[model samples]
Target chain A: MNTPTPAHVDGNAAAGVLREVFAVDLTAAVGQCDNCGCAVVLAEARLYTRAPGMVGRCPGCQAILFRVVRGPDRTWLDLRGLRCIEVSLPDS
Target chain B: MGIVSPGFSGRRRTADLPPGQYLTDDFPVLSAGPTPRVRPEEWSFTITTETGREHRWTWREFRALPTERPTVDLHCVTRWSKLGTHWEGVSLDTLLAGVETTADHALAHSYGGYTTNMPLADLRDGKAWIAFRFDGEALAPEHGGPARLLVPHLYLWKSAKWVRGITLLTHDRPGFWESAGYHDYGDPWREQRYWGD
Candidate 1:
């Protein structure tokens, strides 16, 4: 198919990889972009997987919000692009 | 390698697969952004040296260059290995023949704002090509046509889809995925999929 341009999916597509590191589903977590200070759900971020790992970019500034790389024995997660990630927990 | 156990029917022979990779018969289309529809008339390949020298070839000029059809096995850092893929393209050695460069590394820039870096040595001596055709057909846009850098020896990302030009660098510079913590030199055989790997 002749697609005019390459397209990216939402961060929801990264859940499988993220799950390897996080105990809970991270797509529902809200992360604030460190570059542009835009706060949004991780699922709302733009996800790119054309590379070695899954890259989540901030929808506001297109800055990489996080990167997750999975290897045979270990998974590397980098969230330096985000100022903070707020994950909601259930009331215990 | 270990001997096969009795009654063990594996999905496929692992002998051909690289470390941590699986064989895929279908070519998967993976892209960071929208596919750039670059018409052949508007396509050109350029090589820029650290000393500000530029060597360019328009699509027509590029097609006129001597081409070779290579059957190569591709290994992606994402763990997919496609074997015996056929391609037609001009070799990097042919393109860099007259270009002068003291650089040891190269950063490939693509039309869709994508970039990947590799040692200059990796692109020479019949190591790499700018492929325009695949499987005896015009390479599809989703698969990086009008042309794409082909470095089958390394992780497929190093091939740089939608590749337009290469900038010679005196020192190695990390590109898109490299900067994002992927290994700068992605070697699937070594399992260099992440930064520290």
Candidate 2:
């Protein structure tokens, strides 16, 4: 994980109850940008929603990513750019 | 693809099946940022300027500061996280207009030295605020309850959660993630997820 440097603008950011960003050790990221096929490093980047069903740009090509919609008993990642991605880990 | 409806049951499922991350397609909703701890009476939100002027208010008064409920999308920095969630609170414009922003300005300041730059115009025209509630219910502690600033644009982290106070700055300062490596302008559409290309 890359250490994020403070841009150092102006003002003070208070510390909260959580000391570190997260205590949970994250596994090496295997996130592929769906668009451009770039690898998404969880340590260095983030994801957010821009619209419904249509996940906003992958940030690589400004391409909308995939999302998980409700399945009968569980939710599934509704891939739009391509077919289902094979996960290295077994299904949860 | 990263889009999810926090307003719907589907989002609940997505939120549950995750690495503790939000699920949504909207850059703003999925990236609504982490919710703050809710401290009803103990909570106090203040606005201070570089000149040493300050204004303080409690959760009670803060809740009454012209609340509005809007269902908007959220974007996250990780990738495609979106949610159409409803928020209620005083508009950032209304809050600023009522107070004195001085010639100096404030960057978005949050817990853990998490601060982001916010130009006057971005805070105007009802673009920002300190949200205290979601939907018609009080905001969850994780959702930055008690109060958290909401900036729909520039990714959700720019909208500091668990915001204790706003300090006027002479210049722009980046927050925790920004300092760590997140892009200064975290545009999900542009995929400006990290610092530097």
Candidate 3:
């Protein structure tokens, strides 16, 4: 049987939502997948927003990288799928 | 209620929205990965009970079963609620008819490995269906075509798109989103989007 491959955009598609929470741009931040330990920039993670929130999956392992849900009063950001995210800081 | 802003023109009335939810006219497509296109001939629906018994149906047999056109509201955990959406499908009750199972929880498995869990109670008594038609048209692939689980009472995520089968479990097991910190029982009214909420 033929199974069509699913399509998705990269984490760059989620920059707008991530910006609502973080002051700095997060698309360039490198996050390590908790499942596979593969690290990639947020912009390279697979992003899906067809549901109620944005779901970012690790391109290497396809495990959830992060999820963002925005409400009228609150925005829920779940990054348990990532072990750690490294964001570049500006040098003083 | 907050004061209306000066010269504010509302996009639409929000009188019927659930807490923390906004009304949306367009049905947004959301998925954890790429859409799966499963041909109807190759498609099958299965129900595996905790007892290890399995009930199966082909696309043709499934379509032959009694079908219903239901108009229901959908609330996504992301806080978007679409009201009065129409669909046609075989009810879970019809699908489960004559199938014996003592399980109280169900994990719906989708075509592309997407899964969601909910109480078996939520799948009964006309609360849910394996919907194949939306607004009088065959469900689109982007919107979970061929057929998708339609559980309007809970958040839309519970309605697994491209649904293929249901496993009746004696105890609840968190599926994809659930294991990733999403609420196990995603009730939009309670604002249960995350684990704590």
lDDT of candidates 1 onward, in order: 0.88, 0.58, 0.88
Task: Say which prediction, candidate 1 or candidate 2, comes out ahead on lDDT.
Answer: 1
Best by DockQ: 1
Put the candidates in DockQ order, highest first: 1, 3, 2
Q: Which stretches of candidate 3 lie over 4 Å from their true place?
A: A1-42, A58-92, B1-13
* DockQ for all candidate structures vs. native: 0.32, 0.07, 0.27
Better of 1 and 3 by TM-score: 1
Count clashing residue pairs per candidate: 5, 64, 5
lDDT of model 1 at position B51: 95
lDDT string for model 2 (A1-92, tens) is: 99899788443353331323223332233456655887644333334433222232344554434443322243334445432233343243
lDDT of 1 at B49: 98
Instruction: Give the residue spans of candidate 2 off by over 4 A.
Output: A1-92, B1-36, B102-105, B111-113
lDDT score, residue B34, model 1? 63
Of candidates 3 and 2, the better by lDDT: 3
* Displacement of the residue A40 alpha carbon in candidate 3, Å: 4.9
CAPRI-wise, candidate 3 is acceptable
Q: After superposition, how far is residue B148 of candidate 1 from its true place, in Å?
A: 0.8
lDDT of 1 by residue, B1-197 (tens): 98998438543455878898988889988877667999999999999999989999999999999999999999877778898899999999999999988899999999977899999999999999999999999999999998999999889999998889999999999998887667899877788777788
| Candidate 3, residue B133: how far the Cα is off, in Å | 0.2
